[model samples]
Target: MSNVKNTVIVITGASSGIGAASAIKLASLGGKVVLAARNEEKLKALVAEIRNAGGEASYFVTNVTDKTSLVGLVEFAIKQYGRIDSLVNNAGLMLFSDWKDVVVDDWEKMIDTNIKGYLYAIAAALPQMLEQGHGKILNMSSVAGLHVGGSSGVYSATKFFIRGITESLRKEVGVDSGVQVSMISPGVIDTGWADKVSDAKGREAAKALNEIAITPEQVADAVAYALDQPTNLTINDIVIHPTKQDW
Candidate 1:
């Protein structure tokens, strides 16, 4: 893997789960990581932990769904480190429910965060990356994007959207620009997501699925792999999961 030493990486959703894991891993590798999330306490604590561990780190409270918030995040990172080397569009929501439940609110929440959030982050970071003549953009996705599952149509659809745009951005922009656009689709990660599921039946299924899930750190390994490649070699996509996971 390429060295991320001094590379400025801004990660959304950095308060927990995959986002938090990536920030730690990248920073440990010498990357100057900027953590962005709405939780000030968690973000502050994480920044201190990374600094105490002798790594460069910073925090910015950001709401990914809001374009202005994302713009501010990019500015904060640049002000801290001068330029953005990568942007991890990891801020997302996954609320599962059957179509019959008509959980419009949950579905909208997923769309707003999972879809719009990613796009907004990209919009805020891509320009800086392009201007610098090189950068990496890793979109956190899921296996559900490749295969729809029961009670997760909306969530799955949002991931599908991620896959589609990642590919398009790679072809339309990445081919000519120095930026690398990639996606990492993880399967059944044990990120305490099951505990957050609001749907009754969906929560039960999620907990059962968690029995076979892998850790977010495992997914972070995949992320570091994808981001640490030379701009000449693009790691387009990676699908990571537990070996026991059937689908």
Candidate 2:
């Protein structure tokens, strides 16, 4: 495993869940964490908490859906820390509904936030990482990406796209540019993600699944573990789930 001390790691969707937990864990491991999320209040509070814990940290209010906003996030990290060692593209959406329900708006929202947002994060961070000759991009996928489930077809599609893109990106950048790309696919994690489900049936199913879900901190630990790997050894993909989760 590589040392994270003084490494500048940027995390998006950092207000809660895996992003927030990863920020705290990485900071504790001596990373200079830069938190980004749309919620300014939460970002400030998290930054303060990191600082109080004797870890270097900062934040930028960002909307990952906007390409320019992600650019600004990268800029903030560079301005504060002088280098971008890794970017955790954890901002995503998971609005689920049966295709028969035709939640077109929800589908568009998922496309914009989950797929496009993931692309924008890569677009914004890749240039600097390439120029530096060594960096990591850890993206958040899901077990849904591996297999389609009931009522989550569109959401699963987005994650599947992420999975393909992360794999392609790893091949494109890892050997030549010294940048490593990784994808974390978590199953039934307990987070605010399910709260975004608008369909009644989807929400009910999510509730039942979350009853046996793993905590966000567990996912965060996986993030830290991936980042801790030696530079030459890329942890390409990780699929984690609660032991009791059959799916």
Q: For residues 1-247, what per-residue lDDT tens digits would candidate 1 score against the true structure? A: 3568889999999999999999999988999999999999999999999999999999999998799999999999889889999999998888778899999999989998999999899999988988899999999999999999889999999999999999999997789998889999999989889988899999999998999999989989888888888779888899998899888
Clashing pairs in 2: none
TM-score of each: 0.98, 0.98
Residues 1-247 of candidate 2 have per-residue lDDT tens digits of 2478889999999998899999999999999999999999999999999999999999999998999999999998899878899999898888778989999999999899899999998999999999999999999999999989999999999999999999899989997889989989999988966777899999888787889989999999999999988888999889999999887
lDDT of each: 0.91, 0.91
Give the poorly placed runs of model 1, Cα more than 4 Å off: none
RMSD of each: 0.9, 1.0
Candidate 1 matches the true fold with a TM-score of: 0.98
Clashes of each: 0, 0
